[model samples]
Target chain A: MARVNATPRRRGAARTDELLEVTLELAVEVGYAGLSIEAVARRAGVGKHTIYRRWPSKAALLLDALSRVWTADLNYRGTGDVRADLREQFLRSAPALATTPIGPVYRAVIAEAQSDEALRATLHEMFLANVEQSTLDRITRAQQAGELVPDVDLTFAAEVLCGALYYRGLLSTRPIDEAAVDSLLDMFMAAYGA
Target chain B: MARVNATPRRRGAARTDELLEVTLELAVEVGYAGLSIEAVARRAGVGKHTIYRRWPSKAALLLDALSRVWTADLNYRGTGDVRADLREQFLRSAPALATTPIGPVYRAVIAEAQSDEALRATLHEMFLANVEQSTLDRITRAQQAGELVPDVDLTFAAEVLCGALYYRGLLSTRPIDEAAVDSLLDMFMAAYGA
Candidate 1:
C-alpha cells in the first residue's frame, strides 16, 4: 500500500488522491448523507468526469477513501509471547482511534452502511477482511506457541479484543487511557492463557 | 422510575404517556431533526398545548420519551465470580442490541447528541446513568468479594466491559453474538481477576 502522505506528482494520480482527500474532508464536515461527487470535485478543484472516470459511485469513492486512510500498524513481533502481541496490537489501534480523522469517518461510514447495502458489502470487504485477518493471525501465532489454549476461538477472541476498544472510542464519552489498555490486555491473558 | 408500559389510570398521566408514545414513533420514523411537537400532536390526535403542558421543548419531550423506553437490563449477578457475571449480563444485553427498537433509538440519539449538548446531557443523566450504575455495581461487588484484584480500577474496567458492546452494537452492522460476549468476558477476567 502507498504511504498516506505520498504526494502524487503524476497528473492522474494527483487528481485521484485529491478527490479522495476532498471526499474524506466532506465526509467529516457534512457526514455521508451530505457528501457528493459534485461537492468533492468542487472541493478538490477537479471536474465530476474525473471522479466518475475512476470511481463508479459515491459509495465506491467513499470506500476507496476509507481504504486509503485506514492503514493498521500490524507490526506485531511474536517473541513466543501471545499477551505481549495482543497488547502491542491494541496499543497501535488505540492511537489510531484517538488521533486520526479515520475514527469519526469510520463512525459515519458505519452509520451509512446501516442503510446502504452496496456500501455495506464494500466496507465489509475492504475493512472487515483486513481487521479480521490481522486478529486471526495474531491469535493463530499465540495458539501455535502454546501461549493460548489450543481450542480457543480465534475469530471470537479477536473481535472481543478489538470490539472492546471500538466500544470505548465510538460509544463512550470517556477517552481510552493507558490503564484501560493494560486492563484489556490483562483480561485477554487471564481468559485465553494456557 | 415507572414501568416502561405502566397503565395510566389518571387522565393527565394517560395523555402524557400518549404524547410520549407519539414522540417516540415520530423519532423512529423521521429522526430527531424532523421530530416536532406539532407533528407529534398531529400524529397522536392531541393539541400543541398538551405537549407544552408536559415538555418545554422538543428536546425535553424526546429525552423524556427516550428515558421511558431506553431502560437497560439490570439482570447481572456476581455469584462471587466476575467472568460468570459478565457473560450473563452481556448475553442478556446482546439480544436487546440485536432485536430491540431501543437499539435504533440509541443510535439516532447518539448521532444527534454529537451536536446537541442539552440532549446529550439529558441522555447521559437519564439513560446512560442506569447502564453505568448497573455495570459499576456488579464490578464493585466482585471487587468486594475478592473475585477482582483489589487495585482494579472499577470505572475503567466498567468502560472496557460496556464500551466494547456499545461500540459493536452502535457502529458495526454485524450482530453481537454469544461468542463475542464470551470473549469479552474472558478478556475482562484476564485483566481484573485476583
Candidate 2:
C-alpha cells in the first residue's frame, strides 16, 4: 500500500511522531497549563510555523499528542470470556495510566479539555472511538454470546467500569494496582455477568 | 452562638465569601487558566494584598471557592432506603454539576488539580471529606440495615457511582439527566442491593 510519494509521507509522519514525543515529555513536566507551541517548537527543534501549520492551537496539538500517546496500543479484540476480556483490556492500560511519566500527560490533557471546547470534542471523540464504543461493541458481542446479561444497558455498564478507571487516574493518590482492577471487574461482572 | 466581637468575625467571613463569589463568577467566565487573584481582587474591589493575605496561590483560592460553591448543598443523610437516597442525592446534584455557571467552575478546579499538587490535595481531601467518605458511610449503614449486600467494597461502589458523574460532568456534552441517574442507580443497586 505504498504511495509513489511514500518517502515524503513517511518522513512527515516520523517528524510528527517526534514532535508528539516531545509534546508528551513536556506535557508531563510542565502540564497543559504551562504547555505552549513555541516551547514545543523550541524543544522539538521545529519552527513555530511548522507547528502552527499542522495544528491551529495548542489544544489541538495536545489533543493529537494525547491520542498518539494514550491510544497507541489500544487494539481491542474481545475474548469469549467477557470478564477476562475486560480485565485484560483494563489491566493492560489502567496501571500504566496511573503511573507517572505518561500518567500526568493523560491527566493534563483531560484537565485541559474541561475548558477548551475543541480539545474537549477531540478528547470525547477519541475516547468514544478508541475506548467507549469499542467497549460497547464487546459488551454487545458478549450479550449475543450469552456471556453477559442481555438486559444490561451497555453504555451505562461501560461508563461505570471505565469511569472508575478515570476517577482513580485523575483523583486518587493510590496507584491503580491489580487488586483494584480485580475489584472493579468483580463489581462490573457481578452486575452484568450472565 | 454569637460572640460580642462576632460582627468583626462575620465581616471577615463576609469578605471572604464576597471574594469567593467573584472567584466563582470569574471562573465561569474566564476559566482557571485566565483566573488570577489580581483579576478577582479588581472585580471584587479589594486590594491585591488583601486577596494574597488570605490565599497564598490562585489554586488555593480556587480550591476554597470551589468548595464553597460546589459543596454548599451536599446533604447526604441516609433515609434507610439506600437506592432512593443515592438516587435523590445524585439526581439533585448531577444535573446542577452538568449545567453551566457552576459546572465550568467545577470542571476548572478539577482541571487545575491535575498539575497542582496542593490543589489536588485539597480537592481529594474535600471530595473524601464531603462526598466519598459520606457515601461510604451511607453504604455501610445500608449494609447494616440489610438494604445493601454485606460484601460489596463500599469504596469501589462509591467511586464507580461518583466516577460516572465526574466522567459525564467533565467529559460528556450530554447532561446527566434523571433517566441517566435512574439507570446509574439501577446499575449500582443491581450489584450491591440485597
Let me know the TM-score candidate 2 reaches against the reference structure: 0.77
Off by over 4 Å in 1: A1-19, A25-31, A38-56, A72-104, A114-121, A146-150, B1-19, B37-63, B70-72, B75-92, B95-102, B114-122, B142-154, B186-194
Chain B TM-score against the true chain B, candidate 1: 0.74
- lDDT of every model, 2 decimals: 0.71, 0.77
Worst 10 residues of 1 chain B by lDDT: B1-10
Candidate 2: CAPRI quality band: medium
**Which lDDT tens digits does candidate 2 get at residues B1-194?**
47868999999999999998898888888877889999999999999999999888887787778777657446675677888888878877775555787777777778778867667777777554467776777788899899888865677777777878777766776678887788788877777879
Give me the candidate number with maximum TM-score: 2
lDDT, candidate 1, A26-52, per-residue tens: 888887778889999888887889889
Compose the digit string of candidate 2's lDDT tens values, residues A75-111: 5656688777777788777755556877667777777
Provide DockQ values for all models, in the order shown.
0.34, 0.52
How many Å off is the CA of B37 in candidate 1?
4.6
Chain B TM-score for all candidates, comma-separated: 0.74, 0.81
